[model samples]
Each structure stands twice: as structure tokens, then as C-alpha cells.
Target: MTAPVVSAADLPRALLVGVDFGGKAFFDPSLDELALLAESAGDLPVAKLTAKRRSVDAALFVGSGKADEIKALVQLHAAQCVIFDQPLGPAQQRNLEKHLGVEVLDRTMLILEIFAARARSHEGKLQVELAKLQYLSTRLVRRWSHLERQRGGVGLRGGPGETQIELDRRMIAERIKAVKERLVKVKRQRGTQRKARERSGVLRVSLVGYTNAGKSTLFNALVKAHVYAADQLFATLDTTTRQLYLEEARARVSLSDTVGFIRDLPHALVNAFQATLQEAMEADVLLHVVDAASPTWFEQVREVQRVLADIGAAEVPQILVFNKQDLMDESLQPRTDEDFFELEPGRSVPRLFVSAMTGYGLPRLRQAIADCREAEGDGLINGDAFTTQPYSESDDQPVIP
Candidate 1:
């Protein structure tokens, strides 16, 4: 295992817990993704435990026996915290912490923490703050219930004190409101830029896919820009746009590299980043990049589609770019570099193989984009549609062998 990104000296040792409800073949028994998430968030996962349960236990989540086991592990390893791969209700979270005698965090909070740390731009920061506030807002309940002895006003009902809870709620609400208002301005600014691009009549394209699927790498490869690209989750939290010139089309298109999606992305987080995600939703076309070398590419593809549908970008025309082609086994390579692959039943889209790293089959990817632009000009996507057609490379361009 790798050392924590933060100073390894005193990094929190975390115990990871994941539950399988059974009958779901997609369940990861090893909790590898959760481990990656914890590592990305600066936690050192000292131990991991997986369990099978038919239903959730409201108070303890994994039930008393499993929680005891978790507590034993925490004691054995001296883990500073317990991290759950599933969402924990407020009561469940509080109960887990009390039972395990350590801090308890769920998948949602782990992701939000990573977002908070990685966000750079003002808009990105504001979005993360809003998400954290919204997420924390839900968890304010019963947390201060222990303060019943300090209750204000009335018959000493001896209920959890409302004064502190109300004050905290008010504070979060005010901050959330302020952040939202600021984000509205950000959205307007983005809309203004979008309008300017619309006026220019250039074809718009946005790169979107699962996190760390090489969208940023491919974006740099195509546009020749220096946007940060890394081999980690949520590395790029903001939208970056650049002009890409296609020689064959004799035209340039507005290309944007947007943040990546992930499994079980919180609704509040998605809602908070609406301004950033809007770039993908309103684009003329989407470059749906995928990790071609991944054995679970189909599952990843389905997850991306699910997110697109959630954000109302499901109808956008997409070009599936199977990236990391250089890493695929020779036996797995398709005879043709470009063809139509069925993204779902009755829906086939243009799929191309290209190595964003080694530049393999890039000529075909560029030609495919040119085809989309020309097709749009021909009222094809807006009227009929663009399909996989033979790509002819421009005479002036050098092909990557």
C-alpha cells in the first residue's frame, strides 16, 4: 500500500467497512474502490471488512455483532476512524461512532472531503462548500440531543436542546444561501461565455466519463492544452475549455474538459456542481471517454449513462472514445480502429479506439470528430443523425503509427 499523501507521520488509520445486500453481482468483495477513495482523501486504510446482509439495521447499520467485530478490529489496529462504503443515516452514524469508540464517516462524506481538498477555482470551491453545508445540514439532527439539560424555553420537556441545533442550522442555511447566490452569478458568467460561443457558431464538445478514465489526458492530446491530468479520483474539479482545430473540417470547435462522474455520487453534490455540469448538459456533442483497458468497462459505461440521465444529459449525442488503447492486449483489439458499438439496446453510437498516452489511432479519433462537425452542418444530428462513416485523413496531417 502507498503512504498517505498528507504527512504519513500522524495520518489517521481508518478501518473500511462495506456491506453486500446479496443478489448483486456488481458488488466488489475486495472494496478496492473504497480503499482508493480513502487513500485519495488522505486516510490510511489499515484494515477492511466486508459483510453480507439481507437488510440494513437502522441503528447499527451492520448490526450489533458486526459492529462489535469492527470495534475489535479498531482496537486491534488502533484505527482512528471507521469508514463505511455505504451511506449512513444520521442516527446510524452517531450510533456507529459511539459503538466503535471512534469517528465514523460514510462514502458521501469521504467524497465531499476529497472534493473540498482538490477544488481550485472559486466556483469549484463554492460548489464544494455548498455540498458540505447541505450534507452537514441533514446530520445536525439528534447530534446535540445530548444537550437536553441545556434546553431553552418552556416546561423543561427535557428534549434535546433546540437552541444550539437551531443556531447551527441557521448558520449552515445562511452560508448555503450565500453560496447559492454566488453560484448563480457563476452560472450566469458561464451562460454568458456559452452565449458568446453560440454566437461564434462553432461546434461544441465536452469530455465526460468516470473519474480517472483519461478524459483530461485525451483533452490535452487533442487540444494541446496543459490542463492538469492525474491518475486519481476527482483530480479535475472545474471545467476547462479550449479551441480544437480539425484540419479536415477546416473549422475549430469549442472543446471542454469537465469533471468526471463516479458511482453513488450524492444528489446534493451533483446539485451543487450544476454550474460545472451544465457545460456537459448543454454541449452540442459529448466525447464519452472510457478506460478501454479496464475489465469492468461495460459497468463503468452503464454508471456514466446513469449519471447523464440523472443530470438530464441523457439525450445528448455522444461519441464513445475507448481510451488507453495502447494498454489493451493484442487479442482484445478490434480489427478496425473505429466502429459503432451499442451503448444500450436499440442505441448504437460511434466508438473509436485511441491511446491518449501513446497517440495510437488518434488520427481516426480526429477524423471522427470532423465527421460529427460535418454531419451537424448537414442537418444530420439535428435532423437525421451522424453515423460511423469511413474517415479520410487530411493530406497535411501526420499520422501516428
Candidate 2:
């Protein structure tokens, strides 16, 4: 369907495409999230197109017919680019770009672009560049015809059959290796810091959640530190940590705000951001923040869980912090401030409702963290009991207003 024209002259108009593979379970029917992603990447979505198929087309992904329809939409909307909700193969991407006569990007590229733009810290920028380079490496074939020309002359840089593409690929390979080496050093440095934290016997708590789920806001509230928090997707890329002193538990917790996760996060990004994500994996406790007001929160939860599992943080002790409680409808709001949420089969984690903006339920959330710290200190922390029995929904506990 045609999208209303946006008046922003600075934003490049884009056409969003989503293909519903009937058998795929991860299909986004409304393409609403894709539109949000486009906006996050500074693209103005002028139209949306969808197609249904049992499998992806070999050449254009959407096949020639749908490709033609998309071309029409692009012309109709005067779109400068077409973005697909699903990842496109290198060949498919190139072919689609050629046929549509506009830039074609898939979800992965769009996410990488956002990351490249949002990264502020030195480490964050390096990680983004590494991921982008890796992604570009695979699509180098025939990306530019000039790169296919042979370079062979007395004064030329290469011998008889060496082409520009080969030189470009070699340069990228060298850069990738260099970036990886630097990241290794950074990883080692982070390891040293984590070791120091461990020596202090302080609990490390990481805030992880779906993007724009108020994770940074909650972190700011808990630690009273100024972190860049906003309502936009992937607002902050750098991991910010601070010391949170709990008066009740008489403990100082190392609280860290991590980059938020999203559905279908690129593998290259996950690999590149390993140093940053290690905080969550090595945390003593994870605050899996959730936007209580979001209609698709359950799906968002599953996506975060999938990412957690990917990063080897699935078994980490997590306390579900349902943020933005003030935005929830009165009738739909949680009856209790603290409860247990079944994150997976036979696995229940402590859940608390809090509005970071309003400061409601923050005290009780602190109490929950203190309780976990106390349990850890007493050596009474049994994973099975901690997750399944003690705070199970079946337990009788007073519900806080």
C-alpha cells in the first residue's frame, strides 16, 4: 500500500518490502516494525509492499512479478531506496538493485547502518566498522564493474591477472584481521576489569532488553547516572556501568546498561559486539527489562530470550523488570508490584513492575535486587530453587499496590 508522503526534505524516501513465507514462523504480518527500523536508520518510508510465497525467489527474492510491482511503488512514491524486512542474499540484493533502479538493502544492512550511526564510543565505532566491513566483504563480487578490471602494467601495483576487486578484498581482509586483533586486546582489557569487579565481591547486574524498551531509562533511575536514554530504537550502543549502593542489603552492585537486542540481530554484529555483550554473560544477575505498555511485548520477550541464548547468557540469573507501568491501561496493569514470570518452560524468574519515569515500584525493585544479593552472600543461591521454587507464582506473597 502507498504510504503518505513525508514532508521531511532531509530524509531519503524509502519503500519497505516484506515477504511472507507461509511456512516461516518469524513473519511480521504488518511490517510495522520494519517501518520503525527504517525511521531509526533515518529513512522516510514512502510505501510498503508485501508478497506471499512458499519460498524465496532465487534471483529477486520476491520474484519478477513482485519486483515489478515494487518498482512501480518506488516510482509512484519517488522512493530513493527499497528495504526488505528479511535478509537478502548477495546475488538477490544486487539483482533487486539493478531491476528496481534504486538502492536495495535488507534488514541486516539497515541495522548495521543504524549501529554505524549510533555508535559513539571508540570501541563501539570499531565494532561497527568491523561488522560493516565483514558484511561488505561478502557482497564485493560484481558490486562495481570497475573493480572487475584487471590491473597489469610496468607502473601498475599488481601483476598480470590482479584485478581491482582482488586488491579491495585483500585490503578488507587485512583490515578485518587488524580490527579483530584490536578487539582481542579490548576483550582482554574488559576481562581484567571484570576480574577486578569479581575480586570486590560486588554483584554485577546488567540491564538487557528489546531496543527502546526503557532499559537505559531504568538504568538511569536505579543508578541515578546520566545515560543517553530515548524512545528511539538502539538509542545507546556503548555499555555504561555504574556503582549502585543498596542501603538495605549494605552492598554495592555494579550495574551496567547494555545495548538492547532486536529480532533477527545480524550475526556479524553479535560477533563484533562480543566484548560489550560479555557483561551480560558474566553478570551475577541480569535485569531483563520489558516495556510493559508495548502490545507485542511477549514477542519482544521471546526475541530477547533468543539473543540471550545466542550470547551464552541464557542460564544467567535474570530478574524481569517490567518498565513503563504508567503507560499500561488501568485494567491491564499488574495486580502486584513483584511476582514471577515464566521466561521459559520450567524456568520462572522474579518479575517486578516499575515506571522508571514516575519512580513507582523502584523501591520494591531495589528490594528484589537486595534479596538476590543477600541470597548470594549467604551461599543459599540454588539455581533450581532460585528460578523455580522460591518465587514461583504458586507461593503466597503479599501483592504490593
Candidate 3:
């Protein structure tokens, strides 16, 4: 069957804003990410508003003063939508819209909308819809506030105080329940596939990291599959796996690309995609790819680690891969500096510096994967899992340039 068509005239123009909220590390990636979301939703980003804050106002995420500023900017730029880098509560969203005189979208909803548009596979679509429903279920009052005028019953007497938002919330809650049931079946099907792979005795290596950190790019280069690799955040939503042949030693392993993680990942999404992340948790090895050239790479690493922890994959064996080596220092001068996490004097994981785009250090990276694979007993599971040997918690081994 043919799919429905959407015309260009239906697109909206939007303004992107990043909120720092004081003293915290400002992650500029969220603005770029917001732009991606806007583009995915067929909107144009005309301006941005960034500010510091101690805490968000319960009514307006940005203070009334800042909200007024944004309101004026929205009018000056004639923007149809305002996108925030932080999630806004239902009351906050309603308050912001009423003050701005324009629609306002928070980080979570904007991301969910993008996922809704990008989801292709049945499971992917179902997961996205389920997450959207859950999010909407929580904020149904904010969405259908306009319907409060039509609460009359079948009889001439109108119902006293039944608001449209409450009714919509009920509908969304029911829909969420149905979606969860569907996802349960999808998860079960995925489980069967995973078990089949495990029985094949092939080493499973999952690539995981912050969004746009080059996981998909490296996956494409290594497995030679043209899975969508872009500079935009969350460009790839669905998990893609390919068989990788490492060496003439007949090393066979399945490398799976997982949905990229981000800071403040909505709980709804996390819950909806639990089965997808299980693929990573069950992997024999994890390639924690980082955009080495990014100024915030360290924070990105921490955020990815946090997500892994949330998904219960923190203890899994991981090899740190610093990608984008073409952007690395040209001198190739080896630096002995250790990251803050590794500053404990004797805590470290294997690390590799490489460029997925330029193909620099890729051979070494692949070789390192093979070496890690060799460390595993019978070439299955993290070798550390099977061995009682005291693994030394040492600094990242010095890379041989």
C-alpha cells in the first residue's frame, strides 16, 4: 500500500533555545540537537535564547523576565514554535505558551516527535508511539486545555467540572496500556532472535555512546554497511547489527549499533526501549565510542556511562574508543594525561584513538577489538566474567603510535 504524503507547506518555523540554569556545565550540543529535531519536524530555526538559572520556575521554565524576552524575540522573528533544551512540566508548558503567544516544545516532546517521524521498522515505530503516548499521558491536560468548554453530558444538563484534559489523559493512559502490550510481544520476539544469536556462539560486540559521537559512522566503516550516519543528534534510532570478520584467524563476531544515548534521556523512552538496550547489556564487549574532537567529549563519556548504568550495563566490559582522529592533534604526540574518572591512580579501561571518517587508526581499533575478543574464554561473554583472575585496574595502556 502507498503511504500518505505530507506537503512542504505544512512545515513550521521554529526558534531554538538552550537553558543552562547556572553553575552547571553548559552542554552546547543540545542546541545543535534541537536544531536537528526542528529540521526533522520540518521547521526552521531562526534564533536562540540561552541563559543561566539556579532552578526552573514551576510556572515558566525560564523566569517571567526571560519569558518576556523570548516572547518579544518570537514576535520579532515571527517564529511559529519555540523549542527548549530542557523538559517542561505540563503546567510550565501551558504557562510558557500563554505568555509567549506561541507554541512551546520541551526537549522530551521535540525528541519524541522526531522519533515518531523517523521510526521505520514496526518495532521501532511501536516503541516510539508507546513513548509518545506515555509522555502525552502525563501531560494530557496541557495538550487539550482548549476542550474544557465542551464537557456537557447527553442530557440537557452539562457536566459540572469534567475538563477535556482529564478525559484526554484517560484516553492516553488507555492507549499507553495497549501499546505496552504490543511492545511486550515485540520484546518477546526480539528475545527469541537474541537467544538464537547466543546459541550460534558468535561474540556480540555492541557499539554504544552519546548521540552523534560517531558510533554509526564507525559501524559503517567497520562493517561496510550504509546505515544512516549523520552529524545530527539521534540520527539513527533503530538498532542495526552486522557480522564482522576480524582476522584470518577466523574471528567471527556480530557488531550491533544501539540507539545513541543523551543526557536527560526521557524515562518514557528508556522504558519503551528496554528490549533494545538489552542487546547492549548482553554483549560480550562494548565499544564506547567518543567524539575525541568535541570539546565536551569527557562529559559525553560520563553521560553515556550514566545511561549504561541506568540500563544496568555499567559492569559490562567496555573498551573506550576516541573517534574523529583526523581532527586529533596532528603531532600525534602521545600525552600521558588521564581523564578525571581515571584519576583514582589505578582505575582504567582499554582505550583507542581513531577517526571513523578518515579511516585513521581504524585498523588498530579493529585489532584491539580482536585482542579483547581473544581475552574472552571460548570467544564468548566478557572474558572477565568467566575468570576469577584478579584483573588489574590500570590506566589506559599507552597507545603505540
Across residues 1-401, which tens digit of lDDT does each residue of candidate 1 receive? 99756576578999999999896645777888889899899889999999999999998999999999999999999999999999899999989988889999999999999999999999999999999999889888756656434555653332345566666677789899999999999999999999999999899999999988999999999999899999899999999999999997899999999999888889898999999999999988899999988777877899999999988998788888989988887778766677566666556677778999989978887877787887863332332333444333332221311
Q: TM-score winner among the candidates? A: 2
Clashes of each: 1, 0, 2
lDDT of each: 0.85, 0.87, 0.77
- Model 2: how far is 92 from its true place, Å? 1.2
- lDDT string for model 2 (82-149, tens) is 99999999889888989999999999999999999999998999999999999989988847554688
Stronger candidate by TM-score (1 vs 3): 1
TM-score of each: 0.89, 0.92, 0.83
Kindly list the per-residue Cα lDDT of model 3 for residues 1-401, writing each as its tens digit.
99878664556768788888665655474476678667776788888878878887888887899999998899998899899987788899899889998898887887788778878888888889888888777776776666766575653333456556666676677788888899889889878988888899888889999888899999999999999988877788899989999973368888999999877788889889887898888988898898887767777888888889898988777777888867766554235221222412344465566789988778876776776667762322223322222123364333321
Deviation in Å, model 2, residue 59 alpha carbon: 1.1
Q: What CA RMSD would you report for each candidate?
A: 6.0, 4.6, 5.3
Candidate 3, TM-score vs. the true structure? Answer: 0.83
- The 10-residue segment of model 2 with minimum total lDDT is 377-386
lDDT of 3 at 325: 69
Better of 2 and 3 by lDDT: 2
Error of 2 at 76 (Å): 1.1
- In lDDT terms, how accurate is model 3? 0.77
Candidate 1 residue pairs in backbone clash: 380-385
